[model samples]
Target: MKNMRDKNSTNSGFTCANCGRTVSPAAKTARNHCPFCLWSLHVDSVVPGDRAADCRGKMEPVALFQKRDEWTVIHRCEKCGKELPNKCAPDDSFEALLNLTALQQ
Candidate 1:
């Protein structure tokens, strides 16, 4: 699968499927995950925002990992058990990221 570090699509914000929170667009890139809850959908297969995957499973944020100075969110698909790491957006909740990291300790 092709790994896209930055999502370059311009799409409208979506409501969170996990927490039912209204999520706004990231303003700079495609909002693949909900910033409020840090949850994502299994929509992309090869490239980010490609929407080629048919799993459509609810992706729960399992953990957070850092590469150098950047943080990435690790999501696990509840339906298909697929795991993917997503690049963190600038406005993503810091507290939520902290909580996810705390789980690893």
Candidate 2:
């Protein structure tokens, strides 16, 4: 059986470590971060949901960026100083996205 941490991964919903929100997985895709606070964990190495990384760092939402007309959130690992870009979910908080985008403007 998978352990508690393994069970509560991107495939399943889990409480957010940054905002303490009860985040649910995306309906049709893997939930990479908390929709409420836009925070993520440093679990994936080369691809999203791969779970091959062992950094276990707290990913902080830093900014909003666009690629091919799609908006993505920039996450920075607090422990390792690595930066990654994640697409915004359908149910992600619009206010949070606006705030991050505004900062860049």
What digit string (tens of lDDT, one per residue) describes model 2 on residues 36-75? 9899989888778777778979999898888887889989
lDDT of each: 0.83, 0.83
Model 1 agreement with the true structure over 1-105: per-residue lDDT tens digits: 122223444366777889989887677778789898899989888666787788889999998989999889989999999888889999999999999999999
**Model 1: CA > 4 A from native:** 1-10
For candidate 2, what's the RMSD? 2.4
Q: Report the Cα lDDT for residue 62, model 2.
A: 93
By summed lDDT, the worst window of 10 consecutive residues in model 1 runs over 1-10
The TM-score values for the models, in the order shown, are 0.86, 0.87
